[model samples]
Target chain A: MSINKDTVKYTAALGRIELSEKEIEHFTGQLDKILDYVHKLKKVDVSKLAPTSHVLEMKNVYRDDKVKPSLPVDEVMKNAPARERNLFKVGKIIE
Target chain B: MELNRLSAHELMGLLDKGDISHVDICNSIIDSIDKKDKSLNAIVNFDKGKVLERANAQKGLPVFIKDNICVKDELTTCSSNILKGFRPPYNATVIEKLLNRNAILMGKTNMDEFAFGSSTETSCYGTTKNPWDLERIPGGSSGGSAACVAADEAIWALGSDTGGSVRQPAGLCGVVGLKPTYGRVSRYGLIAFASSLDQIGTLTKDTEDAAILLKIISGHDPMDSTSVDRPVPDYAKLIKKDIKGLKLGIPKEYFIEGMDKEVKQSVLDAIKKLESLGAACENISLPHTEYAVAVYYLVATAEASSNLARFDGVQYGLRSSQAKGVIDMHKKTRGEGFGDEAKRRIILGAFALSSGYYDAYYLRALKVRTLIKKDFEDAFKKYDAIITPTSPTPAFKIGEKTEDPLTMYLCDIFTISANLAGIPGVSMPCGFTKSNLPVGLQILGKAFDEETILRIAYNYEQGTEWSKRKPGI
Candidate 1:
């Protein structure tokens, strides 16, 4: 139930965030305190209760599969850090 | 004429009477923001020329938008370094509605990065000072919206509430903050924080202004599936209904130990005021209240981890120059881009939702969330509304709780449950502490029942003089 610096680092890596050793140690201590506080939920017996992921009772929202006007290529690419004519450019994905 | 200090409805009256033009009101607020914002730092992105241009083109009251909400081609950085220069290509549903009503688009205000912190200090741009006392914090992540309204820099503003983001800050800054029912407003163009808990709300000079602004923005949109296809009420008119014979619940769990004595007394006084106005009050219990903060952090951060995954260096925002590969690019970009609190939440969230731990953390928290929602549902069946303090204390000093993240997380103790239950809540200036900082009284209503809370807030606001006072900036 306790987290160490390695676990913190591993979790950060899984979340796609690279943390320094200092950050890993810092988060290890902080997350322990937070998770300790959260451990109080273990006492509440919720065995028969259903988990409420969302408050509203929503059904599958179906929309007509019509061809809708989309954002222009230039406007969508405007915020891209690196881009080609119509596609976002990124670092090489494969060797 | 000090038009900046006037509420939106008051300005509307003047504009209708030919006593003032939209340009005149815009100029007044622009002047006030120019003079006061340097000291307060409430507004992060403001252009007088753009505001006046909107005023000239659209004859409506100028409303400042929190930076998280997109405004079409305007820089919509959520007070974070990662989103520097990132402008959304379209307007939020609320923005579209406001524009359709001829409302002038005031500039963007500051907030916690990705709406992550309870205090505005976590913002990458710099902290927004509480107008009441510059040394103290403005309750956030809607701190800038509340501060601007309190200081007359904005007539009204749009702020998204995840936990107590909108209401707590409004209470701290001596303004009115109203968070409608979760599905009441569309979240189409709002930058995602926690998808389920996020609800766009208002910070305004008074309850009437809150109601008016809420009316303009509250409606279902085809873009947001979660938004209910229900008819939007005319809240401005509905709020005027008398609270006679209305039943109010006073939840004892909220008045816990370590709470500020003045805040408790102010809320107690507000209850007395409600009783005197013919609304009956009775003690009630929301037993699951103690676990709300724990449940919220789990649910909110878990969703945040997923929502924020989109910030990788591919499509938008800051991309690191030194990244060697795609995976390395995402890691380096997020590592360098996000602030400390954001990283903390993201890591904590990933740990909770990681395999083997998911059932113990996220799933258990969701079950507890149901109990919390039932607490209100059970209360609302007997009482028309539930009342409590918006925050446990008046605005704390800037650096007071910054060192202890747990202490800062506990600051939203009283306000987080409303979001957990997906109910409507409002924080209005009920009284002030001895040092003159504002104390907010919160009223919680049933799901999709913003009218009851807004009605109670409206009547209480009308019977009180606290909303009349302004920060002496």
Candidate 2:
């Protein structure tokens, strides 16, 4: 139930959040405390139960595959920090 | 007359009679916000011209949309630094509904960063202080919305409840907040916190206003596959003015140890008042209640971690320009954009969902969630509604539970079960403490049975003096 530094770093990396030494320490403490509390769920017998991911009993909600008007390209790019023509610009991923 | 202080229902009457112009109401609100907001810190953004223009176009209540709900072309920051400059291209389905009805958008109110905390203190904009007592917090992540309604800064407001985000704040601020059935309201445009548990609800001055707003927003939406296919009822008209012979259950587990004595007394007195008004009160059991918070953290944070992953630097929010590579950009942007609580939750979620821990943590919690939902289901079979204290205590001091996140998490223990059960729930002012802080009584109903709870709440609200006491902010 304890959250160690390695777990914090690994999870931070998984979530793409770069944590500093202090935050790692802070989060390790906080997460460990939280995990310890959540660890109590182990006592409850869930052997005969099914997992409920959503309350609504729904399957794929189909819509007509027809063309529709979307935001103008300019509007689409309005909040993009970096853009080139009609595409979002990102740090170089390829040479 | 103090038009700013009137409820939406009352205000609408004046508007219908041409006794008050939309411009008049809008200017009164603008003036009130200008004068009172400096002390309350409830409103994060406001522009008179924009509000007036929207007001004049469609004559509806001046409503505040929680900062998390997108309003199309308006800044839709979930009150986070990462989304600091973001304005959504399309309105959330709820916002679009409001617009069609001519609901005036006052401005996006502040909230906990990504709806992670119970108190508004977690908001990056700064803590939104409770209007009743300036040093205490207005409960959050819908703190701004509830506080505004309590302060009469807005006639009604829309807030998204993941786990008591709307109700807890509403309870603390002496207003009314409702979390509709999980699929009763569309979540299409609401910024997600916990997808399964998330619901868009209302914060209003009274239960009637809650009924009015709830009716407008409830119904199926193609954009939100989870929205139920049931027909929306006229909740305002459906509310029974009398609760004679109505069966209300008082779950003994809700009045747990460490609950503030005054809050417990207020809830009991309210129960007595309901009984005196001819409603039958019976003690009920919800055995799985203790494990709710533990299950909630696992289920909610897991969904949150996945939902928030979309905020990676590339799409529409802040991008760390100093990074040399794409991955580095994402890491830096998220690290910088998110606040402490957000980082804590994402890491916790990522840990829970990570390999080796997924089965024991996330899956088990889901099964336990089924147990919690069943508890409510069983209770509903026997009782018309369940009642409890909305929060264990009234509004607490700003820094009261910040140092210990678990203590802060427990503030929502009583309210989280309603979300897990997918039942509709509401928190309305029941009484005030000796120190003048407000206490709330929670009324929970069966899934999609908001009408019954609204009726019970309306009858109780009509008989009580609590809802009539406005904070002299």
Candidate 3:
């Protein structure tokens, strides 16, 4: 239940966030402490309880398939870091 | 009298009587911001010209918005470098509602980066200093909103609370803060922190203003499917109703060892004040309260890690220039963009939801979350509301608990349970400590029952002069 440096590095990778050596070391300690604290949840007998992913019991909210005016193309792309015409530009995906 | 110092309700009275124009209010606020914000760092983005222009057109009250809430074409950064210059293409539902009512969009306030921290120190714009004592923090992620309101730099503000982001800051700043019922306010455009837990709340000079702002923002919106399709109450009207004969539950778990003595005394005094005003109070148990922080961190961070995945260099927001591949781009951009606390949370969340740990951490937290919600349900079956201190202590020194994340997390021990339960809660000033820092008294109500908590807060506010005492910064 304790976090180690390898766990920190692996988790950071999964989250797509790069971590420095210092950050990994720092987080290893902090996350270990936090995980150790949260380990208290193991004491509760929640065997019969359902997990509450959401507070409200909502069903799949469907909407009519209708065409509606949306934000202008320029407005949508206004904040894009790199764009060409109406398309978002990104780093090459394939070799 | 300075128009900025008056409550929104008071300003509305002046505006109605033709004694003060909206422009006058804007100018007065401009003066206040000019005078106080230098020391406070409460407001992150403000253009006096834009505020005055918006005021010239709108006849409604001026309302400050938290930086996290998107205002179309405005710099809605969430106080993070990742969102630097990333203006939203559309307005949040609450922002639209305010504009539709002709309310002036005053400016954006500072916050904990992506509403991630207890203190406002994590913000890219720099920490917002507490008005009571500049050396201390303005309890945060909604610190800017609370600080501005307390210092009168803002008439009122909107802040999103996942785990006391609104009420805690409001408490520390000596302003009234109310977190509406989960589905009460539309979250259509609020930058997602934790989808299940995040609820937009109000920070204002008084409970009446909180009630007024909540009324304008609460209600169903087709854009947010989670918004309850129920009629919004006339909170201003409901707030006037007395809390006579109302039964209040005070959970013993909230008053624990190592809590500030002054804070405990203040909350107890508030309970007595409520009793003297005809509301019956007694001790109640919410045994699962001890597990709220654990559950909240797991649930909130899991959602945040997922929600924040959208910022991965493909679309808007900060993208790294030094990357060879798209995957590398994401890692580099985020590593450089996020602050220390944010990185810690993102990694912890990823670890919890990872293959081997999901059951023990994230899933178990969710199961415990059910118990937490059940505790409130059990309490509400008998009591009209639950009362507790908003925070374990008043504002602490700016760097007091920064180095230790656990101690900082403990700061929210009293406020996190309300979010876990999806109930409405409000924090209002009840008394001040020996050092003159304000102590907040929180009132928790049943689901979709904002009216009750606001009513109790209003009544409590009426019995005390705490809300009237502004910080002399």
Candidate 4:
């Protein structure tokens, strides 16, 4: 349950955030505390219990497949902070 | 017309009586924002011209929506930089419902980016201050909506509750917040958090106002696959104050080791007040209560990781330009667009869902989630409603727990069970801590029994003066 500084940094990197050293230390302590508390779950006897994902018993409620008109592309792109050639422009993904 | 100070119910009454035009109300609200929002920064965007035009053509009541909900032609950032300038092509089902009812769109309120934080400070625009004490947080994700209602910036506002976002903040700001049963309201327009747990609810100054807004927004939405097909009940017609012979359960597990004494005492006092109103209170045990936070973090984060994957800046939201190709764009944009909290959750969720850990983490948590739901079901068989402190402590000061995620998660201990069980719960102003910060009492009802909880809250609110204790703004 102990979260070391290195692990914290790794996790932060995966989350795409750069944490300051101070934040790393603080989060380490905090995450350790939370993990300790939640560790109690290991003791519960749920051998026969079915894992419940949705509380409602119903299933497969879906909208019908149909062609629907969309707002004009110009109106949709009006709010884009960056755009080009009628497409949403962004930073190139590949190196 | 002091549009900023009127509740939605009051505004609706005025609109019905033809005392003021919807345009007048929208104009007054916009003016109020211009006058007050300098210090508050509660509203993210204001479409005054469009709002007025819409108002002039219809009823004059003003409505503030959480920034996460989609509205055509308006930015739906969810307060994250990733969606900094994204606008939806269509209105969310709720927006369509409001427009059909002729409610005027006031503006979009700020929230934690991606609805990820307990405090509104995580919002891209800035933190929404508690109206009572400006330095403290307005309990968040729904912080802006709660603050706007408390400060009377908008008549009534809508907020989404995934875990305790709406109820916790509403309690802190001293207002009425109702998180209806999971399927009671459609989530089609809501930016998804934990899809299973998220429900759109109302934040208002009074239970009756909550009732009215709920009635208008609650219904079957063909657009939201998760929305229930059940008939919308006549909520406004059933505001009863009589709690006579009603069975109330006080869970033993909620009063845990770290709970604030003042909050515990205030809740106990509220229970006594309810008893005085002819309700019988008895002790009950939801033994699985201790596992709620763990289960919530696991399930919510897992869903969040998936839901947020769409925000990689390709089709919508903020795009990072430094990368060379599509894959880089996804990573770079997500990296730059998401806040620290949102990132932490996404990473944590991804880790939980990873191949080697799925069973031990996600699957195990799901099993415990069921145990938690069973606890509520078993207890509700014996009791009509369960009462608990909405939060273990009053609203903490801004930055108090920002670096400490555990403390922030602990703040939701009392409110997470209802989300897990997919039941209706309401938080109402009950009392205040010595710091003069407000505390809330939670009334949790059986699945889909929102009316019962609201009736109890309405009755308690009428008999007590706690709701009137506004923070010294």
Q: Lowest summed lDDT over 10 consecutive residues: which window, candidate 3 chain B? A: B51-60
Q: Candidate 2 lDDT, tens digit per residue, B109-144? A: 989999999888878899898999999999998999
| Candidate 1 global lDDT | 0.92
Greater lDDT among 3 and 4 belongs to 3
lDDT tens string, model 1, B1-473? 89999998998899899999999998899899889999899999887778877788888888899999999999999998889899998999999999999988888999989998877999988999999999998989999999999999989999999999999999999999999999999999999999999999999998888888888998889999999999988888999999999999999999999899999999999999999999999998999999999999999999999999999988888999989989999999999999999999998888889998999999999999999999999999999999999999899999898767888999999999999999999999999999999999999998888888989998998898999999999
User: What are the per-candidate TM-scores when only chain A is compared?
Assistant: 0.94, 0.92, 0.92, 0.80
- Taking all chains together, each candidate's TM-score versus the true structure is 0.99, 0.99, 0.99, 0.93
Poorly placed runs, candidate 4 (over 4 Å):
A1-36, A62-95, B1-3
Determine which window of 10 residues in candidate 2 chain B has minimal summed lDDT. B52-61
Error of 4 at A15 (Å): 6.8
Give the true-contact fraction for every prediction, in order: 0.91, 0.87, 0.84, 0.55
Candidate 3 lDDT by residue in tens digits, B190-218: 99999999999999999899989999998
lDDT of 4 at B175: 91
**After superposition, candidate 3 runs with Cα above 4 Å error:** none
DockQ of each: 0.91, 0.86, 0.87, 0.45
As for model 3, its CA RMSD to the true structure in angstroms is 0.9
Worst 10 residues of 1 chain A by lDDT: A1-10
Instruction: lDDT for model 4, please.
Output: 0.84
Q: Give me the displacement of residue B470 in model 2, in angstroms.
A: 0.6
Backbone clash pairs for candidate 3 read none
